[model samples]
Target: MDNKTVLQFQSLSSLVDPTFWYSLTKEKIDNIKLSDVPLDIYGYYSYNSLQSSKSNDNIKVPSFLQLNSNSLTNEIIPSFSFPMKGLLKNTNTIEDFQKLDKKGLFEKVSKKIWDSILNGEAIKCPSLLNQFLLISFSDLKKYKYYYWFAFPALLLENPIYLTNTQLLSDYLNKNELQSLHENYQKLLEIPDNIKKGIPGYFLLKKDDNNHVKVGTLSEWEMFKSDDKNKTIVGFADPCVLPNNPGWLIRNLIVLLKKKWNVSKVTILCYREIAGEYADLSQCKLMDIEISGEELSDNLPKSVGWEKNIKGQFGPRLANLGPTMDPNKLIESAV
Candidate 1:
């Protein structure tokens, strides 16, 4: 056959739908090459319920099968036909084939075939016919959830696979694993500086009237005599701060100054040294220290500020009435 005719036959043969088999003709069956005949024949018989039994007379036997009638009867025909007939006897639809418990079904089918082979009732063609039966059954089991996780991974361009760390460690030297751990630690640190436009670090203070203000130095110019009335708090690591400082400061001013009306916002430091702040202002102090490894392990559960205010950032902020006033933002910063 020419290339175009071969391509057309292939296109029709690949279809598994019952509609393809019901419309088959004797001339079309005769024209297909002998090697490609088995697939089409299997497809036709598997979906044979869509066509009446009387229509089988219209389909011609392939020339190769007619020439080797004894071999076809002894092996090839039984290999392709019986297992499909047995499977279809129990299954009504494609979904029935997919929902079958594969392990139990494989054991049951193999045992029956083995018994027939041992009794000399049916000839076994393990390299040919028997292989086809086992493979076709396996395909039916896989078609159900084949693309469940794969489709999302393809779209995201991040396919994840399960790995055995112990197997991988056996192949690598001890020094390589230590180097990998050190590199991981560097990745987790908060950077000292960000891009040029953003500020590095600063301190925030809560005054007697419960107003939050920011300044470059730890000590603010406006100071009161009573130590109990004022609170001093230090903030650093701007690289870890989400959104710009202007946006964050505006949200904090609205939340702390206007909404909560609190005298102070305290940050309990983890994994850091205590300071000598005698010269600085006296304030109510609470200290809780934790190791870096413990902080890393517990960070996800302890931090939830992002979940509460995520919608208030970026373009979504427009939905929240008017933006924070520029004059009030300037007043909050020294």
Candidate 2:
């Protein structure tokens, strides 16, 4: 294992569908006019993502942690998994959006994640690990939406190094893969688990008999054998890249180091084809080692405000003018 193989995580980007803007427009005009209060919203990532999944023609489509009309509602789409509970702050003006305390906001959210990890809340309800912030200024007049998304991550004192990386399919033999799949499906069948949306992050291990048992984060200790090396921790990976895992894995490693106090661990970046749960070859398995995790109660330096297309620190603009223009809607209707 090369010590130079430092593990890196891919950052998050906002993927707002037109339906989301349309719904927000209706919400603002019909209800939340001029109100700057934050609204409860959620976004989700899936195992069956285009980044890792193929289309009917076998081409890989683009993917994202998308927000649409459904994201604004409480309705749960099973396939739209790992729901990231988020806050939506629609500012009254562009100045307000611009002047918002971005660093302050990032710190605040990161603290919550840190607290959850320390107090064991995240171990119980893993969705808190993926909480996000969305600040926006919807220009109703121009039908353009300006927004920035932040997925805050807690930085560990010691960087996690990649010991080795391999395809998950190749890591496990045919029988072992079958057991993992069967147990995972059983985990998803828990109705309460379905409602709460924390099943994406899981702990699993194989017994001497080669039987696999999947458990919630809270059940980690119960499923653990004497050897931490035997246990594998995993998350539903959202990254399409073959090598890099998604952004949330950073804080998860933090949680593992600080909470579990593990120095070496095996990580499974679980990826699957959308609507095709049987395909797991796209998943990546990694062996990583980390040291020097502080037990201090204070939160570490926070990062993960999504960067702009130019890779600069800035907000992104979504000009939905044409599709949202009322005159064009009427004209096209005629």
Candidate 3:
């Protein structure tokens, strides 16, 4: 295929980088090599592993987190599961790292990635933002923009899901929503009103072809499957914070809202924060029982689960969804 055809293909579809796409076709974008590209272009690259795997075999697009064991190889996606406390010792930026770390369980798994960047072993850690910085870190110092900046900003956002079930079953009662917010402020000392604009329902869409798609409560409409009878629902544990998988959730939500016209979205989270303290004030909070089966099917939004070229730095297998070349988004913006 010529460069134009490749470029055209990238524009019409979801891809992270044309080079990465080319690498995939040439068998370069497999499990473990890093691409030298800008982070913004590849920000959502491989948001889900299952989604990546399906993109190779199936012609259709899959959700970033829809993981089908049948379609994916058994190789586990490498990642470190670090505690919040341990990360503090290695890095000075605690809050920023906490927000960017998501799951707070990566230090050990991403050690190679971290060590590679620190020791200059490889290009950079295999993350969207970090990859770009690692590639251009020396010459780009004048820009004063590093991936670390996003870490703290996104962390300061403090976005989280508060399950209704958790509220009712766990600690907070309906009446306690307000007080809990106050308590959360006192405990975390994250400040008040900083948690605004957080949404409640994390909508996940999967097609009959076994492809998992993700979205926020709003994006639920773009992924309404051909089966008109299907009910769109929340896919993962509502309590989880914004990791790559959660980023998939955020992307799905953001994309759905942009592409589709829908109304009345809600979510069920597994934790209880003050209503004022919770990130999603717009959502109608409810306590519902999310089924285990639904969660399992909806989880891995894509087929390739962390088995792609970039090592453990990208989203987990559960996060990758259909994406276009990163060049498409970043180059155009420039």
Candidate 4:
């Protein structure tokens, strides 16, 4: 592809399950009190999205990233989802939330990503490339939550270009596809991966013997081969579109370019279609050229603060008073 042939990706959409707010409510009333410190939270994107034309589901464009009751807990993340780490900054009052430096907060989170890439940490655990932020104010009395989400992405000085795209089936034979499925399943079976969560980003290695294996980001050095076909970087893609991959691909290209000095790569947009199993038929294979231009001052500009419901740059409000307030529930029952 020429320099003029740029790439476009589908941004990830957040889905905060109701149980998540209930869990936060309990945590706040019981532990947080008047504190405004940020808390570590986790979220995951489901592979079985409804956006695909082949899907039998009713909804369109179902959420890519989701937060549930257990997202803030110290327990195991469930299967069939690719995990991502994030921060939850909950203020004690709405006034405090309103006063926050939104752009500064965005830059802070993005800087962490940039630092990780520079320090070579992101090469070991690529999920750091997908770091996100959430800011909120829980109205205890009114039972309303004012919140916003930001999925930070590094801007490339010279953008990546897509030269080719195809389905996994078209790229690999049936045997190779089976090997990939079995290997990736083993990756999900690792004990620690089950406990915390596995990185959505991973390595797919097909050796000279044509033996395919699944590996983590840390294995990239050892996994690399003279023949480009030997290593394939794959991500558990949440985007259901045929052409556009998910938002996280943006930072991955930058990390690959900056840290490893790789100007081009083949990416597998892995997907699980229809049910709780990996489906190669739904996956997309992409060959792209990453412009390895050095970003000025090593601090790339970022984007991805979620747009409000009105399609403007702002936060959203979730009112739970009628449904969540105990007093209201009791009054309705009486």
Per-candidate TM-scores read 0.17, 0.91, 0.22, 0.89
Q: Count clashing residue pairs per candidate.
A: 0, 1, 63, 0
Question: Which residue pairs in candidate 2 have backbone atoms (N, alpha carbon, C) closer than 3 angstroms, thus clashing?
Answer: 48-274
Q: Give lDDT per model, in order.
A: 0.22, 0.79, 0.25, 0.78
lDDT of 1 by residue, 73-143 (tens): 22233211111112211222345445645444434434443333334222222111111111121112112
- Order the candidate numbers by TM-score, best to worst: 2, 4, 3, 1
Using lDDT as the measure, the top candidate is: 2
- RMSD values for the candidates in order, in angstroms, are 34.8, 2.4, 21.3, 2.9
lDDT for 1 (candidate 3):
10
Ranking by lDDT: 2, 4, 3, 1
Query: What is candidate 2's lDDT per residue for 1-334, written digit by digit as tens?
Result: 4555888888877788898999999999989999988888978777565633334545654246779897778576546466788888899899999898877777777888888888988887787888888889999998999999989888877677888888877767778888988888887887677555556788878755656677887787776546534667888877777777788677778888788787887788887765544777777888888778456787898788888888997889999877889886787788
Better of 1 and 3 by TM-score: 3
lDDT of 3 at 22: 33
Which 10-residue window in model 4 sums to the lowest lDDT?
A: 54-63
Q: Which stretches of candidate 4 lie over 4 Å from their true place?
A: 1-4, 50-63, 194-199, 208-210, 228-231, 274-277, 294-297, 330-334
| Model 2 misplaced regions, further than 4 Å | 1-4, 51-62, 78-80, 225-229, 275-277, 330-334
Per-residue error (Å), model 3, residue 72: 20
User: What is the lDDT for 16 in model 1?
Assistant: 26
lDDT, residue 284, model 2 = 84
